[model samples]
Target: MRTISHGISKIEKGISILLMFSMAIVVTLAVAFRYVLQSPLSWAGEISVFLLIWISFIGGSLGLKYKSQAAVTIVVEYIPENIKRMVMIVGHICMLLFLFILIYYSFTWILSPSVSYQKSTTLLVPMWIPYMAVPLGLTFAAVHLLSNLFDIFQKGESQ
Candidate 1:
């Protein structure tokens, strides 16, 4: 379980780092070209936009793995430690369920023939190519949530 959690965290971090760096490069080149050279790459914007989507979804999972999702922690701060842990476990369970549903529906949408026919306006790439990031990221987040829940359960036992 520890190994799985660690591996998922590493994978999430690696993809996130790559996406952020690539987005910076893509946006920088797009800006430099449009302003400096007076010619913009049509594909650049589309690629960057899609990359942003991927970044956002992947970052969401990373946030869950790190337990950094912003909520009014004030509410839980005063609660008893064990109770707080249970509350957070429930929260993680909710996150897992939501991600599962999203992945299921998004996957179906991705595989639909209509989706296959749709293409990005500028890049003309199949829309599913960009859409796939949603399920992939959500699935990773789901796995991380499960792993974290396991950790929390064991934590309660040790305490």
Candidate 2:
């Protein structure tokens, strides 16, 4: 399970890095063209927005893998170990369920007739291309959550 999680995390990280690099280049070109040449790129803004969405989602999944997400551990700190483990498991389960729900609806939304025929104003690409980040990111998060839950069950409160 850890190996699978690691593989997924690796792929997500690689994708995020590439997207970040592309975003930087696109923004730089946009700025250079707008300020220096006085001719703005019509698609730059839209592409940048798409890149940012992907980066945010992928980075969020990485956060789950690294356990770097924001948490209010103040109350948890004083709790008994067994109860704390239970709380953690329950929290992860809740998050997993929520992710699954989001994944299901996102796919439905992406495949709907309205969205299926839609395209971005500047890029003319299918709208679902951008919307895909949601379900994909949520799915990655779900995997990480399951991996964590597995670790908890196997290791017994070591987390």
Candidate 3:
């Protein structure tokens, strides 16, 4: 289980790095075209927007895996140990539910004919391609949540 989790983490990190690099390249080209050539790349804005969507979704999933999502822990810390455990369990369950909903809707959204029918006005790429990141990220987050829940149960059993 540890190995599987580690592998997923590594893959997520690698994809994130690639997305960052792609965004950097797009920004560089956009700037060069607008300033150096005195003409903006018409497609740059559309491409950047699409890349931003992908980055945001994937980054969110990575955050879940790392438990890096922003949260105020002071309230939880003040709670009694047993209550805190219950709160943690409930929170994880909520996250799992949220992820599952996201995955389902995102998949349906991506599969809708409207997605394939539309193209970016400037980039001329199918909208579905960028929209795919939604389901992909949600799936990753759901997997991480389930894994964490399993770990929690295992620890409880041991105690």
Candidate 4:
């Protein structure tokens, strides 16, 4: 289980790094084409926008995996230790529920007629390809949440 979790973390991180690199390359090429060549690549802006969306969603999933999302812990800090555990469990449950909703609706949206009908203006690529990030990211987040919950429960049982 530990190995599987670590492997997923590595895969997520690798994809995130690739997304970042792709964004940088796209922007750099767009700028260079516009300024140096005096003619911008027609697809550059559209493609960059699509890639940026992918990057944001994928990075967000990795953030959840690492528990890197921003939080206000002031209230939790003031709570008694016993209550803090309950609060944390509740928080995890809420996150799990939110991700479940995201996964379901995103899958539905991906299969909807609108996504199938739409295409990128320049590339003519089906919009669903880009829209796929929604479900994929949510699935990653769900896995991370479940793994954390399992670990928490295991620790409790051991204690």
Candidate 5:
């Protein structure tokens, strides 16, 4: 299980990094073309937006795996060790529930006829392609959350 989780984490990180680099390059080229060459690439803006969407979603999953998301840890720090563990487990469970709900609705929204038929104005790509980031990212986050909850349980058992 850890091996699979680690593999997924590595893939998510790689995709996030790639999307970030691609977004940077696209924006740079867009700027150079519009300002320096006096020719604008209409699709560049749309492509960059798509890349950013993917990056934001995938990066969010990475944050879950690393427990890097922002939190008010002051109160948590003062809690007893066992209480803290309970709190962590409960927190992760709540997050997983939220992610699952979002994932369900996101998929429903993506599969609707209107959304399915729609396409980006500049890129002419299916709108669902970009909108899909929501569910996919949330699914990855759910996996990470489960892994984290498992770790918490394992630690509690060992102690």
Candidate 6:
């Protein structure tokens, strides 16, 4: 479980960083081409937008793995340790439920005929490619949370 947690941390960070860097480069090039060179690339905007969508998902998973999401933890901070452990378990359970729902609906949505047929304007790629990000990202986050839960319950550790 620790090994899986460690591996998720490494891969999540690496993928998020790469996505961020790619977004920056792609958007920069699009801006430069549109304003300076007077040659706007049609695919540039679409591609950049696609990258941004993916970055949000991949980066969001990393945020889950690291517990970097925003929270109002003032109340929890003052709670007892055992109670806190219970709260943490409940919290992770809720997130897992949410991710499961996300994965289910997103997967089905992608399989739907209309959504599967839809394509991007400039890139002309199937819309499912972008929609797939929902399930993929949520799945990653769910696994990370499960890994954390294993450590918490079995090893008596906090996330």
How many Å off is the CA of 152 in candidate 6? 1.6
lDDT of 4 by residue, 112-151 (tens): 9988999989999999998998898788778888887777
- State the local distance difference test value for candidate 6: 0.84
Judge candidate 5 against the unseen true structure and give its global Cα lDDT, from 0 to 1.
0.90
lDDT of 3 by residue, 59-125 (tens): 8877877789999999999999778778889999998888788788889899988887989787688
RMSD (Å) of each candidate, 1 decimal: 1.5, 1.5, 1.5, 1.5, 0.9, 2.2
Give the whole-model CA lDDT for all candidates, comma-separated: 0.88, 0.92, 0.84, 0.85, 0.90, 0.84
Winner of 1 and 4 under lDDT: 1
Model 6 worst lDDT run, 10 consecutive residues:
150-159
Candidate 2 per-residue lDDT over residues 1-159, each given as its tens digit: 788889999999899989999999999999999999999999999999999999999899999998999999998899998888889899999999999999999989988999999999988999999989998998898898899989888878355
Regarding lDDT, does 2 or 6 come out ahead? 2
For model 6, the superposed segments whose C-alpha errors exceed 4 Å read 155-159
lDDT of 1 by residue, 23-99 (tens): 99999999999999999988998899899999899898888778898778987899999889989888888877888
Report residue 89 deviation for candidate 6 (angstroms): 0.7
- Cα error, residue 105 of model 1, in Å, equals 0.9
Candidate 1, which ten residues in sequence have the lowest lDDT sum?
A: 1-10
Off by over 4 Å in 1: none
lDDT by residue for model 5 over 1-159, one digit each (tens)? Answer: 566678889999889888888998999999999999999999998999899889989998889889898888999999999999999989888888888899999999999999999999987899999999998888888888888899999999999
